[model samples]
Target: MHPYDTIVSRDVDAFPLGEFLDYPRLMSVDWREEEPRMLSAFFTATGLPADGTTLEMDDRTSYYQLVRGSDRVDVPWGDEVSAQHSMLVALQRVFGASHSIRYLNHGCADTASFVVETNEDWRRLESANPHVRWFFTPIERLPDVFKSDIDELVRVGETYGGA
Candidate 1:
């Protein structure tokens, strides 16, 4: 399993889907035949400027890359705790406390993809809230360092369908 670079909520309307198109580091590669003008127009409609830097095409696939200055954002990719914290902050910024934020991390080969169920208690956001629900592959498949963490999460979830 690979660590997820993107987190998506299962609910389509949980947040504004179009906001994802504006993410600075988002890069997409599509294997399709389409006109350049059409691509440009699509990007423009999604709030991306029609500058030359927004799109790229190769013999194999066509892709869009959203580039921005690195100074603008700080994303945590190396540490799990940091990454979780970062995601919590992002979800709060995007959806606030009105919605139950369920997100999936599309992990890669070396990392395990997991789903986080963010309700009031998850992430210790509110004292009155309940515990967070974390879902992942079996504990045997996780790294040694992560095993205990997963076990604890499982133990917590056993009472509330968290696993």
Candidate 2:
């Protein structure tokens, strides 16, 4: 049996996720700010300092973002859409493939809802532009050391990074 089955036994089907993350209340975002300020907010909220971490953001394209630390954390949140997308990917990794997921896009929904919507967006983007970049595979391919470590999961602005 799959390891995730024990954790996701209660779930019946896949749906988009809704705010499944348990970030600190201190997290906030300023969409109007420039990239640097946005970056600063991300690190501050996540309690990570600059020159202490290496980071990456994978969305339409894979790009490197600034962070402090030797290990890597992937941050994809900056806007609501990206946050949704990030949440979906996170759920898939955590809950296992058999679990149902969804994303309501607007109002409150269960964690599964969030995952579906985010994934739907990602799929739409990829379909429109096959060249569109995505970090899902790369991140999914990461070794277990990075995937399971909460300490390695760093947050930035509205994004998150993992070892």
Model 1 scores a C-alpha lDDT of: 0.31
The clash count for each model shown is 9, 36
Q: State the lDDT of candidate 2 residue by residue for 33-105, as single tens digits.
A: 2334444544453343455433356455563343334333344454233443343344334323333233212
lDDT per residue for candidate 1 within 1-163, as digits (tens), equals: 1122232332224423244444322223221223343334334333444444322333243222222332112323243423333333332333334323332112222332222223432445323222212222222223322222544443443433232
| Cα-based lDDT for every prediction | 0.31, 0.31
Clashing pairs in 1: 1-108, 1-111, 2-107, 2-108, 2-111, 3-107, 3-108, 4-106, 4-107
Candidate 2, after superposition: displacement of residue 44 in Å? Answer: 3.1
* Poorest stretch of ten by lDDT in candidate 2: 154-163
Runs with alpha carbons beyond 4 Å of true place in candidate 2: 1-25, 30-36, 46-48, 54-61, 65-68, 76-163
Highest lDDT against the true fold, candidate: 2
What does candidate 1 score on TM?
0.25
lDDT score for residue 153 of model 1: 41
> Which is the leading candidate under TM-score?
1
